[model samples]
Target chain A: MGVAPRPPAGDEGLSALRRLLLQPEQRRIEELGERLDDPRLRARDVGRVLPEALRLSATESETGESLSEALAPTVETIIHDAVRRDGRRFADALYPVIGPAIRKAMAETLRQMLQSLNEVLEHSFSRQGLMWRLEAWRSGRPFAEVVLLHSLEFRVEQVFLIHRESGILLRHLSAPDVAFEDADLVSAMLTAIQDFMHDSFSSAGRQPLDGIQMGDLTLWVEQGPEAVIAGAIRGTPPEALRGVFRRALEAIHQTQAAALREFHGDPAAFETAEVQHILEGCLQARYRERPRRTSPLLIVLLLALLIGSGYWGFLVLREQQAFEAYRERLDRAPGIVVTQAVADGDGYRIEGLRDPLAVEPRSLLGDAPLPVERLRFRFEPYQALVPAFVLTRARRLLQPPPTVDLTLDGGVLRLRGSAPAAWVEEARRLALALPGVTALDDGALQDPARAELQSLRADLGRQVIHFGVDTPRGEIDTPSLTRLADDLRRLQALAQSLGLTPQVTLVGHSDASGTPARNRALSGQRAQWLRRQLLELGVDPALLAVRAAGSDEPASDAQTPQGRAKNRRVTLDVRLDGAGGETP
Target chain B: MRKKVCLLGAFAVGKTSLVERFVKSLFNARYQTSLGVKIDKKSLVIDDQPLELILWDLAGEDEFVSLRLPYLRGAAGLLLVVDGTRPETLDTALMLHEKALDEVGEVPFVLLINKADLAESWHIDPRDIDRLVARGWSVLETSAKTGHGVEEAFVTLGKEMLGAE
Candidate 1:
């Protein structure tokens, strides 16, 4: 296309050619000028940089203010248009933020409410709380309501803001959970009562029936020029509650002055925010907590009582144990029987039979916890057949010396050790006579003179008379025989002194040279000869015995003459005994 | 609309008995003994407008106790009861009317010749009641025992009180 225009590119042609050639460029330049001059074009140019400019401006507060102000309505319009087009989208976009915001606000409110209810929670688990719970059940009310009722010194249940002239309820407020009938009627009755009071009691002036009481309920009326604040209260309301009602009525009269004056059958005028608030304030309750106090004197008294009882119980237990131990001791004591052991009031009574010779019952109480004075003993005297009692009776009757030990075994009384011969004889006589004593065994019992008697018998046994060869049965040495006779006499004296009958045994021996029959005859003759000599020495003939022994049991060797002489000797044996506490 | 209506008459004139069956009572008769008045509520519709009437049944006025005039302070209407067997009760009604007029101003009122169940023994002449009726006083005969004219009397008075307002 430029080549075709180049053919016409001479002075005119060239001018024409120049015009044609410059046409596109000239049009582009003019268009560029127009675009630069046009506000719409400039606007498009600014639109391209607007976002970046705004972003930069935002970093500086001063520039951002103008930019933000410039775009404020547009931004709002765009958002508004967007919401109008799809509100659900906008709502969905905001739900996440709004939900947590609302939740936080609600949680804060709940926290504040819980703080206010802290006092209520404190009383919820208290003793008084349980009582209020019961009352709540009985009265068919809420637990919180019952708690308020009891905790409050006085509760204004319902408040009636009545137009004094019309006796119409202008506004009413009641505590939560208060079930009331028509407040209008109550207000009217209150006015009527006031009127009745004025009519009956007053001659000229007005007399308001400020208070009306019916059982636990009290209707307190506080009168103003145009309104009467009548409060139906439970429990005994303090006098200050009257002041509250008065101030409330005065406040209502002030705020609802024209309304109260022009009040007709309709009560809409008094339902104002101020009037309702004032009436609600009148419907108040005083939550005065009951004081809790613990008396110290009561605690002290209780402690003292506890300790006193404990000590008394301990003493009683100890006494009982002591009594039991004493009873056991008596049960184990021989010759002592406990038939009855009972506690009689503060003392003990013991009744049983006891042997007279046995230990005293009181003496058996060793380190007893119970005082002796607190015990009464009633014992009947009876002979105890127990061996110990029998032995005791034997000792008591026989009067044996300390050397004598009296013991009972299997119902037999045995006396051992040494004692006077006269005492031993008496014990033997009486031991068998005692009850429960079958027999007296004095076999082991020894007399005090028994040693001297045994020594005398030994001396008599040592005496021997020598004989010449083949001299049998007739030879005697006078000096030795005399000594033997003296010993026999001493033995007899000791045996008699010891309350014993003495017996003398004479033994004879012969030499081995003699024949057996001859030796036996010869030895017997020698023993008879010795026994005769003993009888002459004052031993009784009935107490003498002779025994013949052959050389088969020799004292010495038979081959030597000296040994043979020892073998042919005469010997004596002695024994003395009598059955009593001790046989001698 | 709530209206306070008062019943005023002499002693034993059936002032309280006339309204006993016609109204809902929140207070017992003990208030009448102590406070000299008992309040009862009568909710009714007149001209399609719900009207609550707080009926203050003031104790009967006699030698012992007079009409408690302050009870009529805000009364929009009155039910002046009269025992028809006793002509003297009509005079007591008239006297109570005078006292009520002075206390509560001129308000809508109805004259009830009560004990009409014993009409044969009625001593109150109809000429006298008719004369009062001609004087612009609303009058009706009512027997509380028979429940006759009892409902109409309160309705008429409730209508008059609403109409007056």
Candidate 2:
């Protein structure tokens, strides 16, 4: 609103000249001012410039400091301001996402704890573990350490260090026995698998694979910022081995930091002997062998020895019993004098004296027959005049006739033969009264007198004489009479030798033509004539007797003349007193 | 010193006969196929070094079964035998060689073309032998019957194994 002051002529001239020179610059400033004054245009300008600044900041966060460290304080302040404004909403929004995740983490931790506990229990109760415990006690070592050493026997067969970005094998260490010809291939494969897992399953924030197990070998992988370490373990390693891997990775990062961070494809930078020495410290190959137990073969041998000895004892007892029974049998035999009866090997040897007349000792075993091979006899002859010997002597002294026989058995004497009556009576009385004789069996013995009588009757029957006619006085032929007398005398002499009284009887018979009274009287007269003839032959009167027979006692047919002459003959009958006696 | 060697081949390739010819110098006219594995030991001195070779004769590979890998655990060398009369046995022998390399890493080995006694009826082609030779594989023509190149095959494998160690 106020009026302007006028310039000097010289200043006015300078101002005109300056105004003409700054005219284009003033117009450009005016245009820029107008565009900056529009809100949409200003927003477009900011949009164009903000991305470069954000990218620069992101690059600084990634390459310089970690993202967590760069954003931690800012995020903390923002979270505090948000919580103050809407704590309930913040909690509600966070619960659905974080609750399950926290629970899953807790569950995984508890599951790992329980798994470790179960493994400890299984190892403590196992047979191999028990032996290990015993060995721990014997060696004065801690039980837990022994269990760790025995149950988790581990051998670090091979170890590899590979660059994470290029999948190049940085360093390799292997046991002398383990061969790793394709270690680079294995590293590449491992890196490829890790990339595949990261692509397939890695979420916003998750770790890559850490381990892989195949049969008895386990590959333990530890990843760092630029390098990865993989170890091939032969057996089950303790969980504490992870610490060793971490320590190795940390050492590699400290010593080979520049090589790991700015690594190309060259593995020579990491192949230093110092790195190998540091990695070798992680290797642990500890093994605890179980103690040997008692063998079962020794126990079986002891039992077999016991059984064998018992069987031998039983055989000895049986042999002793057999010998005892043999001794008892020898004591009961009377005729044998046993001098020696002993067991010799499998049999018995017996030496004694025996009597020839007595029963043999071998015969005494009738009730109990022993095996012939098990018995041996050696005896000498002896004269033991026992009861049997006395009986035999008595039989010989009797001396009976040739028809007599004697038998002595079981103390009984028997006579079984034919003899004279006197001889039989003598044998019976002598055998019954003999010493050592229990009984006499003479019932079978017979006298020969009865047999002699039968012979005498046959001789007298052939010498019968008959009258020639029916006359009371028959003709006595001298030669015929002499023969008849000789036969009668022989019969009488047989009876006398038999110690018997002989008696002769004469009988007369008549024909039917004569009268009964006259025939009877004539037969009586013929009997008296025959009796006198026998008396004249020097026979005893007591042995001569006569009998008369009438026509009722016919000798032949009575109607003929020869019959009448035969009927008138005199018949002689002889009898011996003792010889004709009943057999005694 | 002692070394363990494994014998691998197809069925009826006469792996046992090769061992008998080398160890006992005896041959049986009758063929008795082996079951599972049989172990035999032979002692020899090569270059003034005493060596005890433990030979593990594994069962031949059939259509229904294959060789067990556990039998090749600590082997230092391998003897791959193929019947000269059967060309298919060479395929089995090569396959087994691959498997053995996978399990035991790189080890010295020798390939034997067995039954050279019947050369007229041989089915193995000369080109196959030439191909193996070109690939730096040692191939020997041996016969358990006529006792040809039997000792050289074992001795060569022994020397290579000793040198490798």
Candidate 3:
């Protein structure tokens, strides 16, 4: 075998070729074998692949579930053991995650409650609420910000600024109505507790006790280099309260640095207003805003007021309209003038002018359902000159006899009924004097059953015996005087034909150019001259009488020369006495 | 002026009874504390100056309960009480005095030998108290049962605390 090694040079090439060909495979196979043989390497390899393997297995649900099922009891036991060993550490570890989860659960619970705020007070959306909202909007702030300023989230009942080294109460401020123990004693006790806790629990005493929670109250301590400020809060405080305390303590440290450092047991050096103000700032509080409950009685009263006002307003409106319609009706009524229609308290005062002949004002309230007692009226009597009312006034004032029918057309009075001569003369005078009567015409006349007497009086009254200007004897109408003398002899013959007594009177009229006394003397001389002429013409002297009617009841318009001449002439007259004298 | 004054003593030294005779305090204040201490208040007008001494009656130092050094912090003065019947209580009070000095640096203090009414069998030698007195310590013999020297002891301590400030 020793001699056989010399023949392996060519075989060395074969070995080299074999090494190149199978070395990688050989190394890999050795690695596999070593991994199987040594548990440490095998475990390392398995550990490297375990995650990937588990991932792949997990994709296949069967192996993943089985693997987890196998691990469940051990994991449970490990967790139980861990919890049993140091539950506080476990709790602290879970704190970060548990807080939000619990908060979310609580939020969900609150959401599920979904209490509807349907019973909110009526004043919430009332005018006052609108005003409040307007104020908030104008200020450009949140409603809650405006409201929560006075609404306290928490109250810091007491604040104790304590000396660091001595634990003496340097300055203290407390909220109103908050009862407390002695501040010095409390300060000492708190410092002792702090020391006790530090000595008992802390490996290093640099960290001070921060807070103590006690049933709706919390004691917060903020430490500074020389002083510690403690706040006793009576409710849940917001996180911003931390910054408040920090800032307050910072201010105190800056301003009261000397007082804090050189503080003795007297505590008088820290009693200045600035330090007190700083401490008072530490006594922060948020006042509570109580939810105001709506009073049922108040609501009822408001409702009653609303309904009562509404009804009263409706009645007022209706009454106003009714009064308007009534006023319109009254205004339209003829001869009624509505001067003032005023609305008084719960009623109307209507003042106007009313013709006595017009319809009543009260009767005009036809369809309006208004209280009769609530209406007032003041009407003054007035005479309306309307045509119908004028006729009525004429009829009332004149009191014309039925036999003498009276008619008025455009203020002209026309009388056309038989009557005695004296009655006819009186009616003519009175009819012309009536209101709104401009003229009178009464020529048609016939005595009842006495045609001759009526014709004789008409013929005699139509004749005119004229006289010269201002003289009785000058330029007399000879033929007219002779005819008037003859008519007077006939009137004496017909006086017995009339049922009533008649008289022929020589009446004289004079021009209105002269004075009444001269005109009356001239008219009487003319009438006496005419009577003497008629008496010389063989007429009965007692049947004719001379009278003077000077410048009155002119025959025509007096402003003309012809009317003046006619007014100066004399005419025959007839009269019937009230007692029928010389009746057949 | 308010001052913090501590009562340091051995067990069964009548420190509480001495404080009760010297001050009016809320009795329930002791039950309110979970710590081994009680608080009382004694107001006095020393030299025409109004002084309020907040008396901290610490629990007696014994085998079962050790003195908590933190309670001595901020103390203006200390009342070192001893039982006249037990000689060892004086040593305990002296030890507490040194402990209090270590916690809160040098302050005024008074040594009170309690139960002096029963001094017929008193175990403390008057020479030891005289030795403490010669070292410039204010010392007094007090009787809680008869209230002898109780008010004077508190007033003396109050005056010292007020003067120290």
Candidate 4:
């Protein structure tokens, strides 16, 4: 009780914190390995090795060891050569510029890798499993989000305080901070010492004196030798400190940079926003490296792939159409003709036959004499079901009917009563030749009396009108005001020839050179000019009306010379007086 | 600082046409309706100082009326157009001028009487033109179809835009 308790040995606690800090390198390597494992990573060469190399070199440098000690001799040589080329004494020396480069390279590599990985993963995780896994991961509680909250504030006092503790600062800080902060010259040495201690403890992987020991803190706490170093880095001279801090970042972040490659997949599709977002998000989360989904570039690349696939699908559809056409041709011989038998030499003239000699006989015509001369003919199986007859003349045989009618209501053939059995058979054959002719109808076999009466009525009303009148001046006529009026009247008569009576109205048109108002006046005068001529022609004045359409309605286009000439014409319309009346 | 001038007027009164004429010195016969405001720039020497003029050719449609005032931000002058043959354009021109004043405070504006090449059929009176001039507004008759008085109109406005009286 009497012995005074010595303050708990402070050096031992500091040493233990140092060990804890060093352990992060190993943890970082493991984290990096997970990121590289994604199958899709394309920069396999770069992504897999760079991050691990950076971590190993940085760790070795912290302990004042060679890269060879942390990794195999082969990997050590690579890191050694890279640092040597960078003109740095050690791998840790290249941290600043190289850290960012490594990170970017890893990101690119990982993005490329994802494309191949997706195929394997898609199959591995059944569709449902993949969907559910994505949902679950998204739904999972977010990791303790560590955001690098940057707040720039002007504090003259903070600078003054460091200046007042000038000697203490320089002894512990670096030369850059001394120069940057404009501290007293003597303070440079003191600040330099503090800077050394800070970097040394961090480099040694020791938790800063002020660092939080708790696993999780409700509020983020940035306190420790690390924080002090950060402050020093901020306060240091922009010129000198820039290099030092940059180097420190490179050293600390090398492993992360190398691991970045695991995330890259499809380097070409890496320009999308999603890929950028993923890289930014992972970096912000301080993930040892990003996963494929976290990479925004990969997402963009995936979108591009989908779009490419859609375009390929369109091409596939076009190919299918071409194939369908090709398939259809292959199933049938080219240019084959089929026809009903009639009595004109071969009895049936070929209709629209590319080659009349390519016709083939059907199975139903078993043992029937195969015609040596392959006269093109349409043989329909349904036509065979209907009775067929050979219509012959003693002297000259007429051409075959274009089509043999086989009208069927359901699955049965209705024939005219007068139809001979041969005609019924021909109808069945014709019906069968055409697709969708499942059944046949030989209406000729319905009733001979009914057939005779129907035929008579059909022939009774069939008539065609042929015109034989000739106009006086068959020479070409320009569409002047006079000729336009005469044509209008002539067209009206043409409509009458087709059994339609028209309400003839004469309209006049003109060119655009004249003033609109004057043009309107001129149009009316032209229309009046036509009205007088029509009256002189002894045309019914009561039936004829005239109006100035102006330049609104052009028969031909007005932009071109020919179009304008055609446009300057009168159009005649025939209006049937009754609803059911016919107009030609 | 460049002065932002908005060319606001009725549908075919030639806002784009006028701007195109001033900027490119070429006229296009085929006219298509402008969808939104287009920005064009030109600089003029006034009193030995280079004054940059940013002309915002505002689309002239009834639907665009709501968006007109926003484009007028930081504006120094407004070019209001009226079809010379259509005396009806005078009312539309006056309405636009009044809105510029009400929304953007006091700003100098010039009235462009466009389509002057067409024969005067709507009975535009000399006194009506003078009335616009009397109300502190400058007026110029121009034809976007031709180059008549087009340059003079912009040159006069350029003086007012550069704050050189």
DockQ for each candidate? 0.53, 0.01, 0.27, 0.01
Determine which window of 10 residues in candidate 3 chain A has minimal summed lDDT. Answer: A114-123
lDDT of candidate model 2 versus the reference: 0.74
lDDT of 2 by residue, A216-321 (tens): 7899999998889989888887889889998899778877889877663446687688689878977777665545333344345546778998887787676666
Error of 4 at A307 (Å): 54
Sorting all predicted structures by TM-score, with the top scorer first, yields: 1, 3, 2, 4
Which residue ranges in model 1 land beyond 4 Å of their true spot? A1-108, A112-128, A135-142, A203-209, A212-218, A234-247, A289-584
lDDT of 1 by residue, B1-165 (tens): 888888887788787877888888888788788888889998898888888988888889889987666678878888999998999999999998998888888999999998989999999878998899899999998998888998898789988987887
lDDT of 1 by residue, A315-381 (tens): 9999899999899999788778899999998799999988777788888888878879989999898
Candidate that scores best on lDDT: 1
Predicted model with the maximum TM-score: 1
Compared with the true structure, what per-residue lDDT tens digits does model 3 show for residues A1-584? 46655547968988999999999999999989988999999899899999998788777865765577566679989999999999999999998999899999999886544221212233346565566667779998665444433355788889999887667788888987666888777776777667677766788656879999998789999888888899999778888888889978887887777777766667888888868887787777776645755646456766887999999999888878888888999999887999999978877899989989888998999879777898898999997766677777777876766777777778887777766667777767777776678887777654443666667778777777776678876356677667767777777766654445567788888888899999898888888888888898878987787789987757887888787777777877776542645432
In the range A319-430, model 4's lDDT, one tens digit per residue, is: 4454334323323543333332332353222333323223243322333333324434343322122221111110012122333333344434443335434545555576
Sort all candidates by lDDT, best to worst: 1, 3, 2, 4
> Which candidate, 1 or 2, has the higher TM-score?
1
Q: Candidate 1 or 4, higher lDDT?
A: 1
How much lDDT does each candidate structure score?
A: 0.80, 0.74, 0.79, 0.47
lDDT of 3 by residue, B1-165 (tens): 777889889988888877786675754545424567777778888888888787778889999889877778778899999999999999999899889988888998989998989989899888998898899999899999999988888888877876776
